[model samples]
Target: MKKKHVLRLLAAAVTMGMLAGTASCGNANQKTAQENPLAEEADSAQTEQEHESAEEVDMVFRGGTVITMLSEDDTDNTAVAVKDGEIVYVGDEEGIETYISDATEVIELDGQTLMPGFIDGHIHEPGNMMTEKKELILPEGQADLDVYKKELQSFIDANPDLPIYKASGMDLQAFPDNIADNEWMDELDTDKPVVIADVSSHGNLANKIALEMAGVTKESTPPDGGKIFFDEEGELTGYLSDAVSLLSTLPIIEYTEEDFSSAMKEFQELANSYGLTAIDSGGTIYETEDPNQYEVLSNMHSAGDLTLRINTTSWAGQPLEGKESDRLIKLLDDSQKYTSDFLQICQVKFSLDGVPEGATSALLEPYTKEAGQEEGYAGTQKATEEDLTAFVTAMNAAGYSVETHAMGDASVQRSMNAFEAASEANGGTPDGVINKIAHVNLLTTEDMTRMADEGVIAAMQPLWFYYDPFFSAQEESNLGKERFEQEYHIRDMIDEGIIITGSNDYPVTADFAPLHAIEAGATQQSPYEGEDDDPAYIRNPEQSATVYEMLQMYTVNAAYGAHMDDIVGTVEEGKKADFVILGDNPLTCDVKAISDITVEYTISDGRIVYQK
Candidate 1:
């Protein structure tokens, strides 16, 4: 048998840079031909004479099942060679030796599965960091008020010096009548402001101090695209939903450029550990009050510290009309200054509706009685159809794609209408621009066909495809059994030729692992441990996708959605050398066991960023 060898350049001095008190996510041995004097001289010398042997590459992998992601039928290639951060060769084991050299660092894959590094089409950057640093996580699935009080008390007790107490992962359904009041939180801490966010992050429960700090009164009206719950006597319940939740004066920790930079490094490491080398920021870059987020990302790109290719989006605020639309356009144009090969700002995001679990997502039909709504309550549309259409058209005309957060069927329909209007107004979606709708949890069959017709991309969260304990009940209760069963039609949408890209919606989603999502997408069932074979555990099993399709959702399909398909997403020659090596092939493993497969190695731009 031919010895498996991965080539690496040993002669070049590899320098790793530390940024913001943390090791940068860039490949430790990353060196481009332009950056290395030796490599440049070698190239110059090679141009002057015919080489006696094949050209020496920077790195090579020859002993793995290379899933190139270029074609489903093509599987003969089993070796890949990298030079100067680009794939130089892709062929069988016998053909790889030609690129081998004494200076090459050979990486033996040891029969692992090599494939393109995963791309999360939608994720919140530094969100995981914020959750880790700021929010005290409450126990999931506890509906009892005492249980929450105990947890909140413990959290408050542990962090006595905090100016404001903050906790997340509160299940809204756990509260009475699915609403929380300030009384309980005030019982815990009346002096200091206390704010607790629901598991969905779409709602917040604040105590009296926090509400007073935000200047919330019973007479105050809810802001546009927001909801302020009131009790039977019209007293403030202190439960804010959607845009109103932003009113909570949760103390914003002043994060500096260095802090954001370090947080980004940590985020990259975590993403790489999950086999992701590229991601779409999902509109987190400009959502925060801190101005240094974009600057930090730009600085990282300039310093070659970015290991992941990030496609960033600006938050196009609600009610995009007239002056606001013009302002958003200017924001988009100004964002171009931060654009780079690794960091792109070519998309704008809109929150067209809230989630169904909150009964705020727009729907054509009325929500079930269980949602505690009067008759004919179909939820809030948030953005007017006219405004959405106009904004989408303008953005598309300006050569920027739009990503809308639309969870309900009505929201999905409205989004499709906007995209359709954009196509008509702009002639078509501009080249390199792919309009996306995130968290397409409830899509109509007709709109699925329309999505394919309009070339709209579905930014889906496979983690939500399963029947989880906490969320599943809430979703079912809110959406009713029939509509709940219709949610996340993955296989149906794929069959309709709609381009589906996978995402974890990280920080919001407990599991950010693509492998876990792959299994969930393929099975339409929970990929968690102890999940039984009970039929009820499966959610729309007929809508389950195959493992290969799931892989494409995270690889080529996601890359295409992010407009990075031309450079990454495949192991083809001339593509960037971004790859993930797995201890077991997801395709060959038992469908339920795919999530258990270990990520052995992750390489980005020809350098190893993760090893396990």
Candidate 2:
């Protein structure tokens, strides 16, 4: 987009953001305010009465930066007053002393920055678990199979009882045939099975023993959208593509509920430590004899232990019970019809393609020497137009919002067509309802124009630019000059009046840092200074945004993406009090240092679930 256009559009976006806004819940069967005085009034007089009889407030966060992540006007102050579990007020230290009677547990945070909790838009907690579980080993920086062999030898020496030695996170481009060819698995101990999962999660390499355990052989036929690598001599090269292929066959290390709960607890704590009060877990709800992680989250909601506000996605076009169409109807019927603000299901997530690393991202053109496909086919398409159109038509009939994973232009094109079909099915324009295209990487100008005209939300992840090596590769080879400029053209998307929000897509990039994501979005540069030092292939950066625009991605605009604009994402009156206390005001700090922000307190649904 043009610089003048960028500034003008941001001006409008900022103005629109000011008008949009997050926290609270009553206990089930709890008496109403008419019967209970504390519930009846939350005024200064009630504070005085409570002070007279009260020992002190439950918790007091004293003297630290408090970034509400709301207005340019909200204070980054000395302290915050919290009572019963909710933040009563946020202001100066001396002003909050009245609530600091005897029972107040005052915490002194020495100069730590506290902002609103981070929101990881697209993460796989289960996938994250795979790292620790199955003992998956990742490559040390610039290191190769020798590193893997050494780590594995040590692991086997330490714990021979662990059945399988499954590892993940290997890089193909980094390894050459001389050092470690595709068939390097033969060097490993065949008796003690091992499988190496690629960092991309798109492929894996397995030893002979592991292959036998997975019941695959050299003669095994590859599934549609999946491949097994073979050497020039027609030998098994130990490589396997497509996650569903590997995960379905890979050996597992089972965990008890306690173990799973422990991991989740740590995950939750980490989120709070980083100032993530609420998250759209980005998984959907549809139940059966067979249930996924979303079902576990639902149970947590039922037990009132779902501490974070998670809005999940329903699997659209993924068969549940009868047909994809039926699932969409059920999801719509139960969408807004569920109680409990802690857990919600409103959006539907559809996977369209694989990652860029494996050249399986459904790009407009194929990579240099990809194994399969017509000489120039980029990647496999997930659904035929008929299937896609039918699904979108059914979704529209059910009046449900859909979130499709559109990475490449071709997949993006299919998503647009489906959106058009869904829109046509609707018979008229549907306003305030934002249907998002998640992880829209490498979108062309045509993609953004269509999104704007069709009102399709571009829920993009800035982290991808930093994670994938393609930014450099594409600049040199694939994109050529003209199309290369269109890569991750976020500034243009915003200028076109398409609502853009940031996502982490965690467990993919290990980039669950929301502030860092914002910094990347605002600066359109990597968080680290030296990230751009290289002369040969600098990551193409986008236009810089004012601090206001960054905040909206997580706030106002985020709420809009989740279809919860009326409820949260800001601190307006009547909006849920889901705000964070930062160590310094982001506005006052240098833009370069915003990513270093710390969180002293995190409030969700007006409850103080975490405090430093």
Candidate 3:
């Protein structure tokens, strides 16, 4: 994702001349005035008659199938009336017309189905934003490996002196030969590093420079359950993940405010393109240092340009004593209170285990494939129970919600116990604090009931089944037959009422698309119709959810996951007017057709953020 920074520079350089030319003339003011006449008029509407109806309404949406996800309790075709950014009326369209004044701007949905803006509960939104800020290395659906490599090389050839050249949309899986083998980089100038990130974002290939700059050695052991690839000769491989020792021994590249602001605009567009009216992102700026750097979502909120309602969170830095931990808690508590109808601060996130492929995830038993034979102990544990108790306890006491990463079942158990311990220490049930287990690829039955009874949210990535062989074929190879069934039990969790939300761990497994996430969760099928279906990996195909259930998970269920259930989850009156106009009703569409359906428009807080 560092590629975004470099791309932004090139973008600015190319536009520098154009900007200078425009600034030299005075026509810009006239154009701005002509474009914003209505806004000017609205601002000046203090005339006699205008004053009488000044507070009447700002806008109205008419003539569409309003699938108001007002509440999980309310169903489809729910119309809404907007006043400012909030929904003033929601229900049958009967009396809604009365709210539409002559001054109101109304849009006819043209039979399009409307629902609460799709909320993707999990996303590396900055990474997604980074992708958008970049030049198109691969056109839409042009993800073939050879073609992608050729394009990337072309980019490198075009920019000779740029020390680092990186591409984002290509897939690591697309190449038959693993990237670490160095076959791909030999053709390029290894003097300057080139890392082509996999679409999943979980792993990336580093040319010689990035590896040396990070000081990775073939003998480099991972800090946790991370994997650092090594050549057969015990030399370092270019691949890095879980083993990066991430926050610790890394050099801090100070990013400028300009970089952040530019990235924010791109990320906002990325969210809207996928019909995301709301999203919960996994990045530090969102949770810990929101004030330090204006996160794209934060900037959007401040400008009231937030087209998608966002509830983003990150975590505390290393351990701190009474003073450090306490200060962190206070910070989150103070920020979580940032109650905008558009952006809401929700939880603090922490990674308990590492990546699945890296085998950093904490599992009770050693992985079957790597087993005790491979170089290390079954992934290293980050925080001990005492440490976890202290951290979680402080967060719980501060009334801050948690979104911890625990891919392995053992790690999941540990995080859950910490939350439980924190609850017990805090005088009562902290169950409603909205702590969640993200990326629960391996959950047990007992965990299910405990989550439901304890009210812990399960923020899961449904896109996994579409990429790689997600079935236990690999884990089973290492563990056994029984281990596989524990992979994805989507229906079982819903049945247990383990409040859930679907997400695309963008730059990791899938792009952040709610429709694709839902289609994967509901049909257990890939969105690409041309590709072969995964018979081996689609675990428990019978466990797929109903259209309404999947839809709610994308809409109300996601809001509920973010603890904004009463606000923008629905298309009802008195709620935020955040919604999307779908090309086809997801609920009414054929099972497989859901993923293929496009969004015609996306309205966030009654603002037309995206229109097809």
Highest lDDT among the candidates is held by which one?
1
Tell me the lDDT of candidate 2: 0.57
lDDT of 2 by residue, 1-612 (tens): 000000000111233533332111111122211234554467977755754564455666666766555566666576666555445655666656776867677777566544444454555553454346547556434346677777766766666777777665565544653112345555655367776666555567777777777777777866544566666666766677653454356555665554555555566666766667566544521122113344566666676565566656666533212377675566445444343556555456777765554455677766544233347757776666677777766665555567777666778888888888778877743443457777776677777788878867767665544322332442224434454445566666777777666566555555466776666666655565555333432344555556666677666566556555455564432345566777666767877687777665776665666776
Most accurate candidate by TM-score: 1
Candidate 3: residue 573 lDDT (0-100): 49
Model 1 per-residue lDDT tens digits across residues 74-186: 67788888999998777778778878888787889888889999999888886757555655877655666788889878777877877877777777666666666777765
Tell me how far the alpha carbon of residue 251 in candidate 1 is from the true structure, in angstroms, after superposition: 5.6
- Provide the lDDT at 227 for model 3: 64
Provide the lDDT at 108 for model 3.
72
Candidate 2 displacement at residue 264 in angstroms: 1.5
* TM-scores, one per candidate: 0.88, 0.77, 0.79
Number of clashes found in candidate 3: 12
Looking at candidate 3, the ten consecutive residues that score lowest on lDDT are 4-13
How far is 290's C-alpha from truth in model 1 (Å)?
7.8
Encode model 3's per-residue lDDT on 1-612: one tens digit a residue. 111100000000011111111110101121211134553464433433443443557776666677764333445444566787787654445545666777888777676777888888776656644443333345434435567667877776776655456665554334443233455666664466566544434445666666777666665655544566666666666766554453233332244556566666677787898788877766632222565543445555677755666666656544423454676666655654455655556467777776554445677766754332264346656667677778878776666677777777787788878878888888854433567778776766878788776667777776664323422233444444566555667777777767667776665543567787677677655555553264543556766777677777677667766656656665654567777888887777787788778888887777888887
Worst 10 residues of 1 by lDDT: 5-14
TM-score of 2: 0.77
Every model: Cα RMSD to truth: 9.4, 7.2, 11.7
